[model samples]
Target chain A: MRATYMFGAGDVRVIDVPDPVIERPTDAIVRIVRACVCGSDLHPYHGLPATAEGIPMGHEFVGVVEETGRDVATLKKGDLVIAPFAWSDGTCDFCREGLHTSCRHGGFWGRNGIGGGQAEAVRVPLADGTLVKVPVGEDSALLASLLTLSDVYGTGYHAAVKAGVNERTTVTVIGDGAVGLMAVLSAKQLGAERIILMGRHQARTDLGREFGATDVVAERGEAGIAAVRELTGGDGTHTVLEAVGHMPAYRQAIGVVRPGGVISRVGVPQYEEAPIGFGSLFGPNVTLTGGPAPVRAYIEPLLPRVLDGSVNPGRVFDREVGLEQTPEAYKAMDAREALKVLVRP
Target chain B: MRATYMFGAGDVRVIDVPDPVIERPTDAIVRIVRACVCGSDLHPYHGLPATAEGIPMGHEFVGVVEETGRDVATLKKGDLVIAPFAWSDGTCDFCREGLHTSCRHGGFWGRNGIGGGQAEAVRVPLADGTLVKVPVGEDSALLASLLTLSDVYGTGYHAAVKAGVNERTTVTVIGDGAVGLMAVLSAKQLGAERIILMGRHQARTDLGREFGATDVVAERGEAGIAAVRELTGGDGTHTVLEAVGHMPAYRQAIGVVRPGGVISRVGVPQYEEAPIGFGSLFGPNVTLTGGPAPVRAYIEPLLPRVLDGSVNPGRVFDREVGLEQTPEAYKAMDAREALKVLVRP
Candidate 1:
């Protein structure tokens, strides 16, 4: 089986690896049908420190159950399914509370000797709890949108949900990336009346507008804040969706969030320290929330919307490539040539 | 009129000042009946630079309305009222949303030439919005508890409410100060099943236990975290009310919070930066929230409880001082000789 690996910075390759097999009673063997490179994957790609043993790449995927251990009662061979970025036992306390990302028995894919999703076949632990069955056939066009249930779409939705976006809310999304666009869509789905997309890229911002952004601010930093404030009648928005995790993005989030509003950060933060004292969040009563999305909890609820043609989150993937072109997929996404690259295994 | 002023670190004085009079159409002059030295006052008492023009001190107070300007329609002369630490025009968007602390036209009591509460009389701006009239007399025994609605009690309740405390939640309050004890009472009022109070002072912890702390962990740092974790089945509490402003308290909040839990901080954060990255908040899906309590929004709801003697938040006040003893009051609180000091002007 061929899988994706990054040996060093900016270096990605598709190499032959041993095929995955069900090794535990709760495990299942999945033949990857679709997977993708995540924005988070770029973090390690930019500075992972050169290693002789390269790490397996990718955590999102939609696959078919090729084999299942005896204990896997909910799934059978040939079932189509989506896997969240992390695997969790559904019965754990956190999982029962709909916070599957915090499940005690859960772990991320491509870690702890687990096979990455960007492979021909991968072993899925806690299969009954981790995989959500998709009723559509393998050749269905909805597969692209359904695959997003694995991570990005759910992540964007989580930001909006955490920030308490509703029909009465005015929101500002501070990015034009895949997740940011999804946040726009999610906010719209949740009935936010106004959404401002802060991004300089014309193409991406255009897509953002189509997804539900009522206004666009093609500025950054202080100027960006000014533009958002101007759009929001000088009070800023009720919610600022921080889709870019850099310090400046965080700063902008603070700058443009209205007093008593919320800043929901979905981006994996790049730095360890940031201002949250009287000078920022505390003084204005701004709430700082958002983290790894419990995509497993969101997948089922969002699936019906995709099936009903009410949303097309799959539009985030502007390009697609086969297993051998996985390296090009990384290059294109890294260079901003592709918003997100779908990988066909 | 006499008012308390801080000339420098450890230097407090009560000096004669001009009597307050209605200055704006929305203003009202209130004769102080009860005012208190807050934990926050110790901040300036410890490090404020010496100056020829001393800064006025104190914000929380219950007073009798002496005079009202033409626009002050709600407050009448002789009405006893509670003034939140900040004065807001209740008509603002933030105030209408029940976040009066962020009211656009609001300002703290002791800044920008406003008279501090620790004075014989105060000219309160936006009188109709800032003052919540109490149906009690000046000498009512409930005066102490009603005074708490101005700041401390409301601030503590704000932490509990922001953390989403409910019957299902297990709460950990990280300070034994007045606000921390009030948080225990508020958590109990909100029906939190398990309440853990973490503080080293037996006297304060005893008070905290009386306020509804089901368990007390009198340890610090790693031991404190271990003790809290042990109390909550090793998963930590669902909500951590951080009533201490220092970084260590914030660290403890991060350490003992369950995955998907909330850390609601009410303390005026002393530092400008802290960790909220993958190693702390992001990986675990922790929500860091809280800021100044919009006491104006909470006063009415909590007033009924205090009036009925269902809760006694005023027990946090351990001492009393007259106007001439203001200097000593600051000294006693700064030396940890008093939990809180009630001042009679």
Candidate 2:
């Protein structure tokens, strides 16, 4: 089977890889129908160092179940399924509470020993717990939306929900990436009265406005905070969705949120050490919550919305490519030429 | 009038000071009935650079209203009251949401130009908003309990509540100081099924057990994490209450918390930065929420419990001293000779 691999920094290639087979009693074999180049995937594509000689490279995919292990009770062969970013044993305490990222037996795809999801076929461990059956038929137009459930959209939704964004809330989304754009949509869907999208790119900000951003702040850092404050009449917004994991983005989120408001962060936090001291954040008593999205937990509830087409998060995908074009897709996204790139197997 | 003053690090003395009078239309002169040294007070007592030639100290006090400005509509000249650790205008949006600590016009005691609560007499700004009327007449046995409302108990309760401690939760209280001990009591009051207190001191741990800590981990750092994990069947607690603001304490709070769980921190955070990258905490998706307690917001709801004697959080007080002996009381607490010191003015 052919799979995408990052040989080194700025080096991505589609290479032939051995087929994945069920290695555990709880495993299932999935034939990938659609996959995408995730923002996180850019980590290695930038300079995280090659984790493996020929690492399989993706964690988000919608596929058909080709086979299931004997212990897989809830799923069967031929089922259309969406795999969350990580695989978890359904019964762990954290997983039970919808926090699958911390599952005791859970692990990430394309990392450690697991095969990546961006392939012709992949083996999914803890299959019953990680795979969500998409009841609808294989509708290609809906593939982008379904694939987002595996990570980005679910993550953005988690950010909005965790921040307690509601009909009365005014939210500021920091970062204009697909996840940030999606967060604007989620905040709107969650009934935020006003959404502020902070980004430098007019094209992205335009899409963000379409996604429900009432205003756009094109500045970064201190300037970004001033912009948000000005937009909010100097009181700042009630909620901040941090979809950019850099230090400046985090600081801006903290700076622009109103007193007692929350900063829900879902950006793949790229920075180390967040200074939360008495002078900066504790005095005003801000609530900080958000880690990885519990995609498995959000899928069922968000599925109906995706199916009904009330939210077509697929709009974030500006470019599409075939399996053979995966390497070029990575470059296009890395160069900021594509909002998000979807790939067909 | 006499008030406690911090002349330098490790120096606390009761010094003669001019008597306070109503300074604002919303001000009320409070003749302090009781005051106490808070754990945070020890911060300055230890090494926080002294502020002035005569800096007034303390932020936890219960007092009788000596006089009220005409604009102080809610407080009377003779009403007994407990002033929250901070003062705020009741009309601010943050104050209305019960986040008085973040009120636009709010300010903490003993800082800026405002007088500290731990004084013979204090001119409480925004008296109507900061002072919670304790309807009943003075009861000596309840003095300690009422004093706790000014800061310690309220802060502890805030920790438990922020962490979502409830009947179904298993909580771990880090730091067995007055606030941490109070958190144990608060967790019990909030209905946590199993409460774990992490402290190395047997004397403090004994008090913690008395305050409803079901288990005590006499370890620090990794050993502490292991102890908590072992106690919770290797899964860790669902709610971790962090009452110690030091770095190790913060790390332990993050380490022992269950995935998807919350770390409610009310300790005066002293650290400069917290590493929250995908490697450390983001992947596990822990929720960090807490700060200085919004004591004003909690006082009204917690007052009845203190009055009815259903909860006696005041047991955290272990020594009593006169206002003139405030310096000795500070040393006693700093030397770990007292859990808390109640001062009679």
Off by over 4 Å in 1: none
Model 1 / residue A231 / CA error / Å: 0.2
TM-score of chain B of 2: 0.97
Chain A fold similarity by TM-score, each prediction = 0.99, 0.96
Instruction: List model 2 lDDT by residue over A1-345, tens digit each.
Output: 998877888878888888888888999999999889898888777775655586778899999999999999999988999999989998987788778787888888987778887778889999999999987666657888888998999999999999999999999999999999989999999999799999998999999999899999998888889988998889788899999887888899889988777888998887868877776567667778898888888999999989889888888889989989999899899899998998888
Over the stretch A1-345, how does candidate 1's per-residue lDDT look in tens digits?
A: 899989999988899888887789999999999999998888888888887878899899999999999999999999999999999999988899999998889999888889898889899999999999988878989888998889989999999999999999999999999899999999999999899999988899999999999999999999999999888789999999999888999999999999888999999999999999999999888899999999999999999999998899999999999988999998998999999999998
State model 2's lDDT: 0.87
The candidate that wins on TM-score is 1
Give all candidates' CA lDDT scores: 0.92, 0.87
Name the regions of candidate 2 deviating beyond 4 angstroms.
A50-52, A73-76, A136-139, B50-52
Number of clashes found in candidate 2: 0
Q: For residue A45, give model 2's deviation from the true position in Å.
A: 1.3
Query: Candidate 1 chain A: minimum summed lDDT over ten consecutive residues — where?
Result: A45-54
